[model samples]
Target: MKKLILALAVLVSLSAAAQRSQDKKKMDAFITNLMKKMTIEEKIGQLNLVTPGGGIATGAVVSSNVEAKIKEGKVGGLFGVHGPEKVRQAQDFAVKQTRMKIPLLFGSDVIHGYKTIFPIPLGLSASWDMALIERSARIAALESTANGLNWNFSPMVDIARDPRWGRVAEGAGEDPYLGSQIARAMVRGYQGDDMTKPTTMMACVKHFILYGAAEAGRDYNTTDMSRIKMFNEYLPPYKAAIDAGVGSVMSSFNDIDAVPATGNKWVLTDLLRGRWGFDGFVVSDYTSVNEMIAHGMGDLQAVSALALKAGLDMDMVGEGFLTTLPKSLKEGKVTEKEIDQSCRRILEAKYKLGLFDDPYRYIDTSRPAKEILTADTRKAAREIAARSFVLLKNNNQVLPLKKSGTIALVGPLANNKNNMLGTWAVSGDPQTSIPLLEGMKNVAGNGVNIIYAKGANITNDTLLAKKVNVFGTRIDIDKRSPEEMLKEAVEAARKADVVVAAVGEASEMSGESSSRSDITLPESQKKLVRALVQTGKPVVLVMMSGRPLALEEENELTTAMLQTWHAGSEAGNAIADVLFGDYNPSGKLTATFPRNVGQVPIYYSQRTTGRPATSEEFKKFQSNYLDVPNSPLFPFGYGLSYTTFSYGDVKLNKNSMKPNEAITATVTLTNTGKYDGEEVVQLYIRDVVCSITRPVKELKGFQKVFLKAGESKEVSFKITAEDLKFYNSELNYVAEPGDFKVFIGTSSQEVKEADFKLQ
Candidate 1:
């Protein structure tokens, strides 16, 4: 019987191996045959993915004759078009009219969600729960695939620190270690283990080559940084996504060292493909290739050849490849082999997407109504939205508002459903969303009288409103003047014991193309909040924003403040749940909120200078800002709970560690206050000395713990050499033998420390 079982097991393993071998052989033969029949023009066309004019205008190029081009086999893929019916129509045109009958790939910027929106990427990162983050992506994939989108331009893994950069709201926060982890999680969620699954979409790690480090926190600005800084702080997440086998990469619009990322060979070929072995297609970010002309990198043809030769596989939106590549090939500027290679990569991606096997796999019109924006999806959005709210302050335990009280909800976003969905909410239905007014009414019940007023417009300027409403109408100005609005808000504040002031930038004010030179609260809204504070009522400030704002005055004047970044469909209900003791606030700040815009690029993991500013007293030679304090308004991992929590001294299992050995660090946390709460127990490490300079503190590990009132729990973390590795001057990641400090605490500023030596 044992011999028979062994034979059966061997037969099963052999059958699996045979299947894989056959699949590889089939793919190779298919590509070889297709390449032989393809002309240089056809090959270049296959490398061109474009968006159409009739659909949503996500970028500069929207082809006027999409149908004619698809029939001529001049376009390989399409993006920006949503809905199953529309996608099916495009796919039908490609399959039936084109000579090759090759299926066209459909991609979309489904960053956070498709129909039922989740929190923005930065807010999602604050959860620090990999499974939850992955689950959010999975749901996004499911919804997108059901709506005929097989590719997602998502998991924006750019490591950013400056809150002034509008796109900072779209990526993982400052630290490379955490950013890489989140990048991998998002990729896994989007692609899943089985890319052939109909519900999954191809994951594209985006804005390659440091788009986050835009100078002066302005969008589309030139970016310049050393290669060492790139490898050490910025490049890890992209590498992590590549390691996770992401299907594609989107080049950034910013220039790296005077060269645009889309045309830079060192970044696309040498670093990404040759070094990292990323066997995927590289797409240009919305006409970034043609924009290179503006960067003084020669004309369109020159830039096209440079991009194609540099290993860029697909030209997104930019017709530069389609219009100039043929001329380049004939002129010997671009070899035919380069075109063939790019075409093969695109074909390989299509094959991986299983498009050749079933061109109509994701085109089911019924699925949209049945699966998109359903009750289950809204519930998931609410759960994630609740998790994204970072409690900035809870002085005197002002939060968890008593369920039976007159709560005055004042400000622009208090009852506004349009802004609840936040920025980059493509296909998300705002009408279905619960506004802050509705959420409070639901949570407080009929017994609680809720007085509401629109404090002020998001911004008083008309030009600002026009720019912010690029996608849709966000700010609706009332006929009442600013003074009248303030008077009404003050009246509401006088009537209620507690005032919930919902104020921040408009939903469209801080996203991809929405950058602000000044990141403080709009003057109109700040005046309204100041007036409410004078009413002598305790105010719970609920800020709705996409990026972190400079809230120096708000922090001091408000009794409690919640950084509720554009929570999707159920934004109001989720905020109300926390405010009324239904749900405990657990969200922590992923990005540091700067005290002032002058203190830009401030993060907890910054390197210690040779003359570090150790004392509050400033010296002329020290690394200290003369105008502002060298501290963020709220540090990374900083959050407040309804109840206070206390931390004990650090307990180490050993004082010394051998090479490649692990050590245990533990701390006791007690919820000393009257209510239950959740705390993020952060663990940071510092190498005292190294061959090269090191960060003052690097977040190595963290665990979010929940406890009832007066409950005590021990939180422990295991540390290894992997946690200590950093990119040296040579750009090689290694751990050096040295003395290390292990700091465990609630936030980066407050910590208990211990020392150990590693040899």
Candidate 2:
């Protein structure tokens, strides 16, 4: 019977391999026939991705003569434009007017959610639920495709440690393991199983190499790190995305190892394509190919040739390829084969998207009303937003505010809808978003009296406001004086039994080029918080930010604090649900919150040094900060629920295992508090000895389990030798026989440890 079953499995596997080979042959033949008739100009045009100036332009320039270029077959793809009608018009020019009659691929940054926005990527990561994260991406793909988009630039998988880097809001935080898992989930969500599906858009994993680890946490700054560090710490997420079948990649604006990522052959070719076997087309981040000229890579024509040779398939919003690639080819600086290969990749992408078969596959015009921002999508957004919120602090159980209380809803974001949708929500409409006051009223009902006050403006600095307001008026300064605003908030707090201060960064304060040196509350809002606290009222601070903030002062002042990462569209409703106890806050902190800006790149997974600080206290020559402690204000994977959970000691099925064998680790988690809640049970492992130094602890596995009050559940994780593997000094991925410590915990810090070994 076993032999018969094995024979059947072999047959099935053979059949699958044959089918894949057949499919590849068909694709290659189709592209070859198409390319044979294409001229040099047209082939180079296939590498040109132009964005018409309707949506957001991250770069300085939008494409000029876009319609004429598309009609002339000088443009391969179009982004920054949506809607079925608009996309159909763009596609018509490519297919109808162009000589080759090729279809134009439509792309968009469908990051979190489309139209019906969810929380930022950082907040989404906080949920620690891969299924939920995948669902969010699925919904985004559905909505984006409904609006005629076949490609999505999302799942920015850069593993960020520094909260100062604004784009941290756009990624899964810190840990490569968690980031890699989310990357896979997001890719699966966006692309689904088949790219040919009209509802499934192609997912683009972005910022190709180490854009998050910019120097001094500045945006678009240079990145330098060892190859070992890259493989072990930063490269995992991008690898995971590629492994999950992401259709495309976007190169970062920053340079790697002093070479611009757009022109770095070692990274783009040697590592990504050669090592990882990524077959996807590579697109440069908004004019990044052109910007390489500034990186001393030479003129436009020179850099264009460099990028093509480096394996970058498409130039985004930059006419560098359109204007200079033909010149480079004529000068023999770039080969016709290199150009052909790049064009072939882009054409393959279009073919996979089913664009070649039917240019208008995604253009229904009817899908928008039925699928976009519908009641179901909004409900999902609200539910997702609630789960994305982290209960930073809840001293004396001050949260789960009574529905009957007279509550003071105060701060710049209290009644404001403008900042609800966080950064990079290019498609979200602020007017459609629910404000905090409105949400409180809707959730609290007639039994509760909700008095509102604009405590202060998001910031008093007009210079900073101008930079952030490039897209829209995110930080709107009020007409009233700061003193008057504070007085009004204090008066409201006195009248109410409790205060809910909605404060933090405006939507544009932390994304793309919005990095901050001091990641703390603006003075205007800080004063408002201080005044409200002085009212002697129990304050429930609803903090909205794109990045993890330094809230040491506010933590001491507020009775309760919730870190809501600019909850989108239904931000108000979601905040109200958590505050009113309709949904318990289960979102953990993906990134660590620093006590101050001094601890810029603080994270839980640092490699142990010979002179490592044993505790918070300072010691001579020890790796410790003199002023601040060696710990973060809020550690990664830290979150609190209305209910309290107690974890039992970890129990392992075996103390040692062979390379091929697996072990099991189990822990009893009990809900000791009065409320039912969900807890993210995190598993971490440390290699006691190895070929090279390893992180003190690395997250290996996790499970989000739900328990009712007083209920206990045994959570187990299957551990294998594969989980113990890491890249050594020689850059070989292997697991050496060594002692290991396994930790099962709520957060990285608070955990029960058990010892094990791999033999």
Candidate 3:
């Protein structure tokens, strides 16, 4: 036994030594070769990363002039150019034409899907299923790599609460714990254990700083927060991605504490590189280095020098580095060592991607044509789309609508294919998508009578119309006027047994650079909805939007509502399936939907003030809004099922526990409604009193339960000291030994609680 243990120990030591040696050898070789052949221009070129001017392209070679650049060694890497053919051609220019023949890396913004569109990032996050989320990314990498693309600018790990932030649709909602989990999931999904595989791509966790907390929920606005606030609330997801071995990071556009994130050494170097120990290359957001001049930081040369010294490895699309880096090097504003360090890192990425082995490995022309948008890809899209739909309101068991009756599908989005693919869907093809009218027709068959009308355009405002038309024509104005469209819709509602009004923002209206001050439904669409409601028909509102909307009035008037935010290729079919009982809606809200725009930035986990308002009387001189309710219209983790479920009392293992010990809390849930359904049982913790003020409630854990009619089951969560830890004023993370309340329920607002203490 002793001999065996010693032998095993020896083997482990040898393996570890071999791994270290291999890594050192690879790094040494890359650095040596880079130093030997690199000219001052070539080294500076390594810091220069550019995006292709046209539509999304991927490959080693994208531009016609790529050959010239490769021969001259004037470029380090290329992004926004994809596909095996283009990548191969580009690789050929570098490997076959250049003296040093350093392979170029390729990247693209494969946010949701490469070809087969899944739900938008926010919609996918609503599922709150980490395995499923990872699988979506895995499939995305499979399709993307198959097309000869290797890097993905995705898993935007920003924590957003404000619905008005259009980019909120691109990240996991407000909680850091959940966001961290999702960040790790996406990293695993994209890179897997081995990125050298044909199916995996390097994961680039983006917006490295606080870009989510843009003021008034506007995009690219100034961001300011205390260091403690950042560490406790916003920085966890990026750290989690680093811990998960993500290959790269992208600096955000927003400034942190009056300094642009791209040029903030405290953020990029002291925090990310030194504290977090992240060894990945840092890429700046699009033209962010140049934009720093507008941000009042400095001139292009000064800002570019600051960015490089601050640890920004790649400059994307700014050309600030290309134009000014040489002068900075000559003036000693930046050193040769810094340039070599950044260049070596870029070379290391290419080496890790196996581009050194064979530059043309991914550039197979046959694969793009064969695998880009196949039938298998569309099937995955349909499944993922169905999972992203959150059933918001279902009264009188109105949903799973009977297919035999006359169904009135009234709205602008009902038959629209253009808006099916939501924001940041660069490669999704809408022509092959299933529109709502066609989907319902296919599902309902000839026996069901379907009536449709264009209730309203996404918006009547011409300015809003132009903004939404940035990518393509989203608001296709109907020939008839608004009054005419409403009349037709109302008339259809009067005749039909049920009405499904598909309304919300056009595709381009709620994405990057698409922030809106007001998040209410467009006036023309609201008028149409009010008219249809007056007809006294049972209405099912199928909302197609990217961001969370303030829909208090719609909630009060409509019979049922479903938030189907850009459901991709199978959107219409998925909606039809749920409406007529083919599939049960299981998605929850990743973001909070507010009652009014005045109640902006409302979320479940928020710190309690000295004068916290727990009830109506506390509002007089407390932290409460004067006109609007403190609560959101729909809280985070809020959703509905066709069936009803009831929660019983929470049972704790013990009334008291030690600091290092753990306890179990269990709750009994009974499915009281007719159909078998899924329910997300949420567990929230409240530190009744702490050294520092704590949130009213923090989501500690949750479970998704499946039960049949009249069936009951118990769900339990294990509590740990780590789960209770929070950053105090001294910036130390520790769990205070005190009274803690555990609340378990369907949503954050509605819950049953029990108190416990730690000794």
Candidate 4:
């Protein structure tokens, strides 16, 4: 029977391989024949992707007459525009009016979800449940594909340690290993097994090569880091996305080393394609190809040619190739062969999407009512949002609030539905979101009284508020003064048995170009929170932001603190679920929440410093800060549940093992506190010695397990030499025989360590 099963497996594998070969041949033949009939202008047009009016314009559209361009065969794709009626109109123009009838690809920043919004990517990563993460992407793909989108600029995958980079909210946090896992899951979820399926869209793993490591945690800033650092930490997630069969890549706006990522052949071609073998097309970030001039690379034509040589296949919103590539080709800077190669890649992607067969495959206007923001999708969003929320503190059992009591729901965000869907909810409707006031009322019975007050404005910083309002009026000044608002909140808290302060950033504060230097609760909200606390009530602070905020003071002040992280569409309902003990939060912090902004880039996987401080004790000569301790307000993988979990000492199968052999690390986790809960049992590994210095620790594996009260489960992880592999001085990935340490923990900082050796 085993032999028969093996034969069947081999047969299935061969059949799939044969199908892939045939599909590739068919795509090549189709593109080759199409290119043969195409003129130079037409070919360059196929490489140009533009944003039409009435879409989420990230940058100024270089060409506003996108419909005319499509008619002229000068536009290959349209993004920023969603909805079937508009997309079909654009598709109809490309098919009926264009010279070649090339169907334009419709792309969008479908980062989390389309219509039915889910949590931000960072918040999704906090769940640490790969299946759940993948399902979120799957649901996102289903809804997006139904709404005329064939591509997604998602699964940002860039490993971010600096929370100050506003785009940090878009990526997996800090650790390369965990980021890689999430990257693969997102890829699988977005692309699924077939690109041609109507439920899936092409996944574009974005910001290629370390955009997350922007200097001083600023957006689009120059990122200068050692190659060793790149391969070990930053590059892994992109590579993982590639390995998982991501269909496209979006080049970042930042420079890698000295060269901008959109025009770096060494990074894009030599490494991404040649080394990693990513066959998918590469799209430039909005106007990134033309922005090469800002990088001082060359003239418009020169940069266009340079980006082409650097393996950029599509010029998104720049029209660089359409306007300048032909000029560059005539000047003998870029060859026709290079242009053909890129055009073919784009054509092949469309073919894989089955767009060539039916240009209007995604243009079903009827799917919106049937598929978009359905009850099922909203339920999924609510469930996922609940899992995405991280419980930072639950001192005095302040959470799991009794549903029968008088609860004061206070803050700018308490009743505001506008900011509930978080930052990148391009297609999400704010009206669909349930506000905290409504959610609490719904969750509590008639026996409960839910009082509410807009305790403060989203923020009081004039300059900051002005900037945040660029996208929309998310924050409006209250008619009542801050003092009056606080008085109302205090009175509400005084009347209630418990207080829930719904406060944090508005939706626009932590997305693209929204970096924050001081990542703490706004002073107005802080004052409000302090006032509520002074009312002598047990207060639960609910933070709603896209990135991790420093909550050292709040952690000390509040009876409980929850990181809601701008959870999308169903934010209020999900928060209410946790508050009312309907769901136990199992989400963990994927990024380090520093005690203060001074510890900006602090992560769990930093190298052992030459003069490492032994403890928080101030060692004057050591690598230590004078005023602040080198500890995070809340460490990565740190989250609390209504019930407490106790992890037993890590047990290893062997003290020593051969490089080929695997070591099994096991830990028994018990739900020591009352109530059923879930715990993410994390497995972290450390290389004590290596070819070069290694990080203090790296997250290797994790398991999310559910345990009822008094129930214990043994979580085990298999660690092979592959888990120990790292890029050495020569940039060769290898595992060195050395002493290693394995940590089994609930969080990175609090762990039980066990040492082992590799032979």
Q: What 10-residue stretch in candidate 3 is worst by lDDT? A: 55-64
Which one is best on lDDT? 2
lDDT of each: 0.87, 0.92, 0.86, 0.89
TM-score of each prediction: 0.96, 0.98, 0.96, 0.98
RMSD of each: 3.1, 2.2, 2.6, 2.0
* TM-score: model 4 vs. ground truth: 0.98
List, residue by residue over 562-660, the lDDT tens digit for candidate 4: 898988888888889988999999999999999999998889888987999899999878989998999888899999999999999999999889988
Taking the tens digit of each residue's C-alpha lDDT, what string does model 2 give over 212-265?
A: 999999999999999999999999999999999899999998988889999999
> Which ten residues in a row are the worst by lDDT in model 1?
55-64
Local error of candidate 2 at residue 254 (angstroms): 1.1
What TM-score does candidate 3 get on C-alpha atoms? 0.96
Better of 3 and 4 by lDDT: 4
User: On a 0 to 1 TM-score scale, where does candidate 2 land against the true structure?
Assistant: 0.98
